[model samples]
Target: MNESALLAILLSLASAVGYALAAVGQSRLAAQGGGGMGQLLTRPLWWWAVGLNAAGALMHVAALHYGPLTLVQPLGALTLVAALPLSAYYARRRVTRREWRGAAWTLAGLTGLIAVTGPASPGDALSLSEALAIAAATALLLAFLVRAGAHSSRGTGLGHATASGIASGVASALTQTVTASLSHALPGGPLPWWGTSLVAVLVATFAVGGLLLSQAAYRGGLAAPLAVVNIANPAAAAVIGVALLGESFHGGPLGWLTAAASAAVAARGVIMLTGATPADLPTPLPTVLPTELPAPEPAVRITA
Candidate 1:
């Protein structure tokens, strides 16, 4: 492989490791139980996890700069595969047989999807109408997901996790757009008047939203919700890349069908993974004293 491809792979894998570690750390904190963001923020470990996540993002951007979206974004799915063993070891959680199968399915399906997406070609600068349309549609979808999560009997963790992934994916696509826009702009030139700064702000908003949702996803466990986010985030990003960024598939219509089928397979895997829960695993609890130590004898038998 060329140096650039090798670098991209290394960076992508490192990014995956960083994200996997962050997920495991945050999941542990969430498992400890807390009332609100304030309570969770008090822990230093939470900050460390945030730092790891940020670092991972930086690595991802670097990878993107050096590689194509089809290559870098798809590799991001490695996070889910990496999360498996990390959760098992660091979280002291069991990896059920079903969970293992789910991970395999996710890996297989994601790989196929990425392979089908093929290489992407950079396109025209994002227009205001396009940006607004995409943002509106995403917002509406997120709103619906939020409401569904609130009322769903199957648990809102998946819904929230999926929302988080979508947000992250959108943010990723916007980041690339902004980066491209900046590069195309002449040095010392004024920023474009067509809401460039507005787009940047929106990017930050989506990123923060995704971060919060990811932490919430851990409230359930590291396996299922993580898998969902893993699939959703990149899938959404890929969509933006194709629709807005002018990326294209290799085989045209046939490729689209293949990609769709692969996505379905990956979605099914996420559902299967959700079946495994922390509750299913053995946990060590503190041994209880058989009986309360008899109240210490009265200090000096003064009652007598």
Candidate 2:
């Protein structure tokens, strides 16, 4: 790899660590819960989480400035690995043997995935029409996931978290796209208005939407919902990287099979990790209901 790619990989890894810390902070806030977004403004921990996320985003943007989206997106998955020990330390959660195994599996698979993929090259900026189409598609999918999350009982939390992840993934792609456009803009010249406007709208929508949904994801529990988010986020970003950004993998049919197997192994690891819970973290009460009431004592039957 070239120096630029190497730098991007390092920066992306750093960003993953930041994101992991931010997730842990947010999960803690969720566990202790008592506020909406407005209310969270009064809390220091919320600010800490926000700051970490912002820092991470900045680093990610910088990484994308120098690296291919495909490379950077997959590297972000390292956040899960970073989060394990951090969660134990900051969240006061114990890392179980199962979680360690999950982490190992994820790490091994990601290593293989990276090895099989070819080095990344710089990408082209999307045309306005292309950007809009991508934004629309992402929005539609996000809508579907939100609807499913609202009604589904089996994996409601996972659905919302996955939606959040998808939104975040789109936001990341947009961020990289915007950055590329801006970089190519004439230095000391006025910015291009039309392209800028579309990017601004799309980026803001997905970023804010992702943040809100992520907060909600924490209500279910840290491990399960977080696993879903971590898994979905990169997968979505990789799709955009491959489809819109002109990135690709090589090594023919054998390589494709290897990549698929690697992804499956990583996904399986996330599942295992989700099953391993941190001891003593209380699940949040349902938002749809008021505080739980005493089970109404069996109403004495009135004489017929």
Candidate 3:
């Protein structure tokens, strides 16, 4: 392999390791189960996890800069395999067989999906309409996930984890689109002046959502939930690539079959993970509510 490719691979692996450590660390904090977001903010481990997460992102960005998307993204699936044993391990929880199976299936499926993702279209920028459609779709999905999570006890973490993956995927898609638009030749001259910045804003919004949701998912075990995020992220991105980014499956009908099978396998893995790692009750934090005012308010109305 060329030096660039080799460097990208090494960086990707390092990125995977960083993400695994960060996820496991956050999982440890969530498993302790003490306080709310306020308390979570005070914990040192949380900050460490955040720092590691940032480091992982930097590594990933560097990898992407150095290598092709097809190479960099596929290697990202390594995070699933790496996080398998690290989940809640700090809490002295042993890895379960079910978690192992889930991780294997997830990794296999994600690998297959990446293999078939094919290359992005040369020099194409996402149209404004396409970006809007993606935004609308993700918004609806997030709303549904949040509402669904609210009613079901077990589904809460799963829902948030799923939302995290989708948000991250969408954010990535937008990021790639905006970045490509700036550097590459656009078919229609250029994207509008505000278009790139608007997409950047969207990217930030969804990236933050992804970060928070994934943290919420760690309230249970990191392995399964992290697996879910890993699977969903690439799956969602592949869909965007094919539908909106002018990428296509290779090998015609066979490629489509492979894609479908990979998706099903990934979905099954997610299902298994949700059942395997049941969510612990989240620590309830205080919510601000209006306290009852004295009857003196009636006197003020009368005076007015």
Candidate 4:
């Protein structure tokens, strides 16, 4: 493989590892009944998760340096596939069969998305006007979600997952914007102040939004919300990339049809996961007997 391809693969792997660690940490926090933004910001474990995420973002930028945005962006979707088994194995959580099916469909849709999308050129950059428009639109959408999320009660799994998905999508979009700005403004020279400012804003937005969404997702059930967020975020990014960034697919109408079909498969996965209930799977029970249990004589006295 070429150097760029090698770099892309390495970055994808790094992103996968980073996402896994972050997911595990976030899930643990939720299980422990961590509160909203305040708890997340104060916890040392949360900071560790944030650091892992930052490292992943750094690797993602490095991958973009070598590979097409079309390629690198889609590979990030692999996080959905990676998180499922990782949660099950490391976190000792059971993944329902339905969840697995849903994950499969989601992956299929994403794979089709990647295959159908046209290749992106290295160092592709957006105009300032376009960047501002995208930023504004994303901000507006986030505001709407925040308003909607506020009314949602705690422990509402689906609501939390939906909110988390929106946050993740916005974060992904902001990251793309930052990547585009940095790539264009810093070519062969010192970085511009405006570009640096954009990067910082995007990074902070991504981190904060992602952290909240992740915590909410864990409370809602890690696998389902995770599956939804992972699929939805990339799907949104792919659409934006195609429409705004001039990405296209080969094979004309047939290709579009195929892409649609792939998306359907992915949607199926998300649907399956959403329908899953914890009762459908076996729960781990306490293995050790209670030390304070009454003696056998109590049982004999109760016989009537």
On lDDT, the candidate that comes out on top is 3
* lDDT preference between candidates 3 and 4, better one: 3
| Residue range 28-48, candidate 4, lDDT tens digits | 788788466776689998888
TM-scores, all candidates, are 0.84, 0.76, 0.83, 0.74
TM accuracy, model 3: 0.83
Candidate 2, residue 96: how far the Cα is off, in Å = 0.6
| Candidate closer to the true structure by lDDT (higher is better), 1 or 4 | 1
| TM-score head-to-head 2 vs 3, winner | 3
For candidate 4, give the lDDT.
Answer: 0.68
In model 2, which residue pairs have backbone atoms overlapping below 3 Å? none
Write one digit per residue (lDDT tens) for candidate 3, span 1-304: 9999999999999999999888888777877887887997899998998899889999999998899978998788888778766654554566677767877787778888888878666665567778878988999998899788867655777788889999998997887678777875666656777987888888999998898888887775666678778877877887888877777888889999998999899878877776676543235688977699656544445553
Best by TM-score: 1
Q: Candidate 4 at 150: error in angstroms?
A: 6.5
lDDT of 3 at 163: 92
lDDT of each: 0.79, 0.76, 0.81, 0.68
The alpha-carbon RMSD values of the candidates against the true structure, listed in the order shown, are 5.5, 7.1, 11.3, 5.6
Candidate 1, residues 178-201: lDDT per residue as tens digits?
666677642333248566787788
Deviating ranges (above 4 Å) for candidate 3? 34-36, 278-304
CA lDDT for candidate 3: 0.81
Ten-residue segment with the worst summed lDDT in candidate 3?
A: 275-284
